[model samples]
Target: MVKSNDSMKKNNILSKVLIGAAVIVGMIIFTIYQYNTAKAWSNRIYPGVKIENQDLSGKTKGEAKSIIEKKYKVGIIKKKLNIKTDARNYTLDFSKINPKYDIDGAINQAFNYGKDRNLLKKYQLIKLSSTKKFDLKLVYDDKPVNEFIDSIEKEVNKAPVDATLNISQGNIKVVPEKKGETLQKDKLKKELSSKINGEIDHDIDIKAPMQAVNAKITGDKISSINYKIGEFSTEYGSISSPERENNIVLATKSINGKILMPGDIFSFNDIVGERTAERGYEAAPIIVGDKVDSGLGGGICQVSSTLYNAVIRANIKSVERTHHSLPSHYVKLGMDATVDYGNLDYKFKNTLKYPIYIEGDASGGVVLFNVYSNNSLAGTVTELSSNVYQTVEPNIKYQDDATLPEGKTEVEKPFSTGYKVKVTKTTTQDGKLISRETITDDYYEPVEGIIKRGIKKPETTPVIPPAVPAATPPTPSAQPSTTPSAPKN
Candidate 1:
């Protein structure tokens, strides 16, 4: 019985050893399979991985990126986004906005899908990757989109036109005002974003929203302005050159027939625009520092000065005004207003209860500015006067001239006396004083008289008298006794 038990024990030991060996072999096989599978997919995306419906199974990172680019990036560049506006239709290419996709990041994510998981989890993930999908985020520059919207806005937007009055002789002609329209940019941008950021398989179509804009000055609001409230004229024909006159006419016409509503500010620079040669402004005299220089749109300052006086006489509030370095001949010392584009501007606000119409004319040697309003204020009179408080004598400036002869002098520029003047404006109704206000206290710089004197000496030639011929004398021996000797005194 003991021998039989030993044999059974040995058999049991062998059975147990065989079972252990089989289990070890099975684990080795499983580990080898897992390692082989992992190595095969090391350089490629696992099977069944996709980016936005585009399958990337068994594809390398580079291959996946190419597929995504072909499907999305290239497609986006070829697609057109159509924008419909109330006025017209606009088409924009998606490439202009620089559309792009995160293909590289998506590919990396796909490649690393099952890399960080445990053995069992990795296996399960690899198995289920056929059903799993990833998204490639779309990106683009918004600046181009905003710029496109801005361009569309400019084309779709319309400015409201104010009613204008044209006065010829005594007849008045009225031009009706027109309402304007503006684009709804915010709403349009939101609508555009939804489509641009979505699937780009087809062309996009969007409708731009719009809103109506009412005119500020309607026809009826300006039709009652018929009476001339204030008028001022400056003589430019006598002092202006042909180019200067042209500038004055152009500037006057720019402000002609303009209407200013109550509380509205008039900007001379905004109305005249830039003084460029392309805008038909000619080279004329303009004040630069203390000297007069030739520049484009030179004589427009006279137009501004004339308009200033008219505005003051109409009781309009001056918002911005600057005096010239030297007193202008066209206007009084303290009454002149100078304007330089981008540097100085002449602005005024309408302070009356009704609209005021400015009628300007630079014809027949005169630049006249007329302010018209309701006839009820016709009896209201305003007078502007200037008083010189101090005077400054100009200094003489001598300049040498080599062209002129010695001791010769010539006056290049005449002396101009500077004055500190105070301007006052008095308002009266029916001979009763309403208000007397000081308009401005201005100081004009003294301009030195320039005299050019000759520093070069004159060239002179030496004069030589002609030599008289020596008299021919008779032979001394033959004529010695011919004449009697004279007594010595």
Candidate 2:
């Protein structure tokens, strides 16, 4: 009985050991299969976008790497998404369909590829999701880049891809704008205000430049700009800018259509145009860039300067004026330049209620300014003599080494005679001269010099065969003339 029992136990132990070994082998094979499936799944890829135009979905992860590795290091394209692309729509249809690539067990692993690229920084594909939107923003130079961002957001939350009517400065014109098509004034103002910074909130520049002098001698108040005030147009054509001229007429306009009262200051430049030939002004000399230069309008200064002096002579306050670098020969040197343009100008207060008339004309090489005012005593002015001094001439100079050949350089400028003169301006209302002022002017010397140069000549010397002293005359005595030698004396 004991032996039998022992035999049964041995048998049982052997069976248990066999079963345990089988289980271990099965587990090992299953683990290996699982690992391979996972690896395959990781390699799987869905249709992915290329940087430029490469399709990523067709390639497995390893294939993705293999394809890019050989193409080009510099141009390796990766799929991505971002806010700036202005994407219309996109999607990965992996819901009902199986993954194109047979990578391991993960069903939709193909769609996750190229997630590490820089282009993906701004966006993420919702696992198995699709979307449509207005194009994403791809670039920005300033922050909160779009000025209308907030306003747009307020009106519509969703991206709006189709909308017209926004016009930039390039498309705007002076013509009347259409309703709904034109930018809203309030909105434009708001937009400009938002874009600009600082005390004066505005986007475009409103600053004007200094161009021509203004002249307003009429005694009546200017009531309108575009309105007809008496015979002349209150609303003149227009001046382009302070630096340039506008091809239009200039009118005496009121501020915001306000009329001027007696004793009120009339600003000329603020309402009228500057002097320019295109605007019907005769060609005259003018100061450009504050420099003395001859331009289309050569004689306008005489008019302005004349008016300046006339007003001063009448004991009136002067508003705007400019003096010449060199004194003028016409209309006395001390005063000049009075013009009637739409904007750039000069103005004075009409102190007297009684009207005054400004009369000026160009005759010969002269501009005469006369002010007609109602007064019991006619004011007259005479300019006294002012000190005059001679101008110094510039020293002559050689242009250059090339311009002047070596040893041939001469004075490029020349020394010459100089000159000076003084002009006295006289103002008269009726028969008497009430005021007088003298202006002195100087002119630098002028010259017409010439240049000359000298060149060295080669030396010439006689090359007589180096001197061989003339052979001493052959001794005549020794040879003997057939006559017997006389002896040794």
Candidate 3:
């Protein structure tokens, strides 16, 4: 009985195993079907893709591929619109797994990339300033250009974009164009412009340098030469600033008869006109050959002295000039230039390549002089202090004009100034004394007159002894001895 039951159990176990096997086969078939279906759906959903632009809304992969395949039959070109900015190669990654990877979007992106790659330039959209040039002109007279020039330089440095642009064929960056570089016809057609705006802010002529010019006298002191104002020179001071007009004449002459060539130097004494009332000179105190006297436009030397400085600051060479005998009170010592008519004079030659314009003025008792040039000079000029030499003179005897008092009644002691000085000129070139000249300044010494108050003393006669006239000296004292009796009678 145990054997039979065991056999039945075995059969039942075998049957169960067979049923399990059949179920496993059925499951395998179902799995195969599902896998094939999924694969067919994947192929249908995303077919051969074509990319034209970046944006794709409803286009399917198969349709996009058809359109691309037909249109791209001629072999698609690798376009590089901006080689420098944008890369030349396509950026799509096929291995990239994205559920929303649209064929149309990819096609659009590829087209944009290719278009940029095909161009010769890496950048575009340049502004007007990059291609524009600003023209400039020198309208005003030559003067100090420090401030305005600096401003112009600053503007140039602050330029936003470089004027030159580099471009070439087939996505290659070419060499940038330069000012004188050879360019293609199309490149030349693309005009580059730069604009600069500026004006004559301040008139260069209006700014008078007022430098100290070296004055030297080549003539002798005792040769009977005199310092005199020369002919007057006229010039316009300013057009805008009429109040700042400078129409005053220089105190001396520097150029005469001969026309000054370019680069000629000028001297004050040589150009000074004869200073006389007849020449429309206002009477002004002047140093006359070592003497103090009144002369025409006596104050005009202030203009000469002022010009003397302007020339020095300009760094021009001084040909000749004569200084005052004694240091002048108007200008500092070692900074005075004196002019004499006919004989004593000051002169200087221009030593520059360009012509220099001199502007002089003497309005309202003030003299202003200026020099204008295009460039700064190479050499420099510095002025040394002037020394005063007082020579002791022999006391001059003069018949006192009783009318003049010995001294002013207000002051206790009379002023006694007795000295003479010849305006001496010490000329130097490259720091070596080239020449020495003496200009005489004859200052008259006032003679002190002896004065006594005119008054009458009380009438007191000189004491005279009373005379006794009784006997007229009794007949000769000699007879008194021999004729005693006669004397008694």
Candidate 4:
């Protein structure tokens, strides 16, 4: 019994020694593991840290920064992020926006992961970071994006078309208003900013940024322009005067298809532009100064004159008008409206309740202008007449011409009769004289006839007298001999 008891005590002591040794070995192992792990993270990033999906494990801060900067900058700047819609597609280029990478900041963040924690907590942090990845923060300026969106807005926006009177193919009508479209710039800007910042690694789809715009003049506003308010026709021989006809055609083309709203003033010179050769005008006879001369864009006055009479018949108010220096055969005296580009212009106002469209056409041997509106003045008869109070006959004038032969006479210019006349417009409505207004009080200057007479004389021929025969010289020697002989005798 005593031997057994001693053996049990020895076994117990050996077991204690083994237990202590095992405990020491375990502590040593744990210390080595902690030291190695701490050492591994002392100058390097955690094992599981990544920058833009690029592994930055076991790298120092500088090394991680180089890797992240080089890789991420190239990928971002060289990548084309497409922003697409059904209508258009655009590319977001990082290079153009001056993209920058915060490699140092990101690397410092990754390197210091779990660095501030205690040893136990740090170990736990490292273990967590090893399995789960952390993403780096990215930043960029949105100025370029905003600017791009503004440019798109400008490109997509358009003004609405207003409803108004229009004339086409010699027919007058009303054109309906059209709605316009514009890009929603603010909305698009916000969306783009969000998209680029949220998803920097992939392309995005953007909706078409458009908004409807209403027109200022709606169809209901101009719905009253529907009838013929005034019209007149003037006869003109097409073959006799082509330049005049061409001038009429061009002026009428410019004036045609024109719409005048209520209270709107119409200026002839402003619409027709300058009459020049570059504008397809040919030289034709025009009244310049006080006489007829060939000038560019002549015969346009005839159009103005015709339109003037039509406007008068329509009962519209004339703002400005001037009679020609000489009477026009196309229209009665004191009833014509003459216009020069810079000096004179024919103007009038709509004065009516509704808008008016001027439809002019020069066809066959007639020039016609029909003003269309909602009001009908077709039954009114307008008669324009000029009564001459005093007549002035031109006198004959003479000029010297050295190029013509003597006693030859030629007519340089024909005489034109002048008159002091009063123009009247009688408007008879339903066989009753509604108004008798004096249109104009004109005084035309008389033009004298110019007769060119030859005053130059021809050169006279000079007559030469016959040459006298030379006196005979042969008697000199005989005379000397005879005189000498006589002296000797």
Question: lDDT for every model?
Answer: 0.88, 0.38, 0.39, 0.78
TM-score of each: 0.67, 0.30, 0.30, 0.59
**Residue-by-residue lDDT tens digits, candidate 3, 1-489:** 267988999999999999998889987776665455433433232221223321222234555455544443212221111101011221211112111223354454433331232111111111111221112221221122233333323332221221211212312121222222111222211221110111212111111111222212111211221111112222223321221221134342222112233655565544555655565566545666545566555655555666765555454556666666555555555556666666655566667554444545465444555554432332223333334456344333334333445532232222334444444544455676655554335443433433333233345789989997786654556544654454553
Question: What is the overall TM-score of model 2 with all chains considered together?
Answer: 0.30
Which regions of candidate 1 deviate over 4 angstroms?
1-78, 93-136, 139-150, 197-201, 220-224, 273-282, 288-290, 317-322, 341-345, 385-407, 420-426, 431-489
What TM-score does model 1 achieve against the real structure? Answer: 0.67
Q: Report the number of the highest-lDDT candidate.
A: 1
Q: Please count the clashing residue pairs in each candidate, in the order shown.
A: 0, 48, 87, 0
Candidate 2 C-alpha error for residue 429, in Å: 11
lDDT of 4 by residue, 1-489 (tens): 357978999999999999999999998888778767877677887777776677877888888877777777676676554655446777767677776666677777778877887776666655566643556555777788777776666666778987866665645456898998888777877776566533345555677578899986677766777667677877777433788778878988898867788999999999999999999998889998678899888888888998988888777868999999888878888878999999999999998877777778877767788877774555666777889999999998999999888999999997788899998888887789899988789999898899999988988999999999988865445434435444553
* lDDT score for residue 121 of model 2: 26
- Comparison by lDDT, 1 against 4, better one: 1
CA RMSD per model (angstroms): 8.3, 22.9, 30.1, 11.3
lDDT of 4: 0.78
lDDT (Cα, tens digit) per residue for candidate 1, span 84-133: 98668999888887888877877888878878877766665565655568
What's model 1's lDDT at 263? 82
Output the worst ten-in-a-row residue range by lDDT, candidate 1.
Answer: 123-132
lDDT of 1: 0.88
